[model samples]
Target: MPTCPSPRAPNGSSSAQLPVREKELTRQYDLLASARRGLPMVRVDRDYIFEGPSGKYRLVDLFEDRLQLIVYHFMFDPAWEKGCPACTRYVDALRDLSMLTRRNTAFALISRAPFPKLETYQKERRWDRLWGSSFGSDFNYDFRAALDEKIPTVH
Candidate 1:
């Protein structure tokens, strides 16, 4: 979540600088320093293993001559072919991700669809990049991405 400042200021300067309190400034500075000292991570893993149509692979496999793996999950299940429209919407927006590749990081897309299904989708989208498919690998369930807390799903 983020703050939404009023479009117009009381004095109407046409723009307003976000106000940061002393405590907030201090906290932000500390966070910045910590980030400079070491990269921030949402979750770190060194020993995760997954399977796919090709074979078994480790988290490091996604690194591919790099040191970081940025992965996005796209829904591509054949059973749900013409897959979940909502998920498709998300995938459709991820067209250009070259900036992530400019650095020493590898970006991959993981999906439940088989290689063939993924190939078809990629062809339709005219996507040139390779996106990893982990169908039957159960990686989604293992990562808790396929589980629905609201309902008992086969995930």
Candidate 2:
């Protein structure tokens, strides 16, 4: 009977040779990270308003006194009754983000749908994450999240 070959590394070589390749990959990743950090930054000059569960809030308020803020552009057109299925799936896959708080970072989800609709959906999904509505505001368009001109205007 013929014996199967030993398990190989991702490059099809023997696993014993992975140490050198792993070090090279680690260096490449470190360099890529440094390049990303050196990229130019754009300053947000406009004071956009968003409606949340409590009330209207300014863009700066979303930071929650954190040093950094990460916004997830959720796709939920004003005319649609429900949010985009792909965006919903992405939200569903997210695990606990408490680590971001400990790191002095804040996260929020922004969508073009009305605040009422967002509130209903949030309740249905049982998501307690910070969510805000950019409805009737230019925040979505300015951020390039709502680029489609065919979307119906919210009245």
Candidate 3:
């Protein structure tokens, strides 16, 4: 860790305050990560199928024999003219997947849009990750990523 000398601020605060704050932030982040790692895992038995560029594929197929699989639920509704910008931004971080692959982990993107639309948007965005479509599938609904049409009105 690097520490900088704290110069006196206009309010008479020492510049050294930043190092303390950074250390505190780092400690909090470590604690949060430890708690996250302690969370329980839920086994998924549902055989959900998704549309891929080549053909339909089951959820396990995305892993490609990897020990772990990470599925990113992208916001690309069937009616939308384009994919969500925020979700697309997430893909930028995955440009270099060598680190993840070395750890025996696989990553895939799933959306509610049709395969053709996903393909078009993926090409436009130039994303190299595997993208799948959950259209006509209960995946989005079951995963709580998409809302159902029937909302029970409160009396």
lDDT of 1 by residue, 1-155 (tens): 99776746666354444444556898988998887669555564435554443566776778888866777766666465555667667777776767777877887777777667776777787666546666666577656566446534432
Error at 128, model 2, angstroms:
0.5
Backbone clashes in each candidate structure, one number apiece? 0, 0, 2
- Full-model lDDT for every candidate: 0.65, 0.89, 0.84
Between prediction 1 and prediction 3, the one with superior TM-score is 3
For model 3, residues 1-113, the per-residue Cα lDDT tens digits are: 99664455544466557768889999999998898789799888899999998899999999999999988888899999798888888886666888888999998999999
User: TM-score of every model?
Assistant: 0.55, 0.72, 0.72
Looking at model 3, residue 131 earns an lDDT score of 96
Clashing pairs in 2: none
Candidate 3 stretches with Cα past 4 Å from truth are 1-36, 147-155
Candidate 2 per-residue lDDT, tens place, 71-146, comes to 9999899999899898899899998999999999999999999999999999998888899999999998776678
TM-score of structure candidate 2? 0.72
Stretch of 10 with least lDDT, candidate 3: 146-155
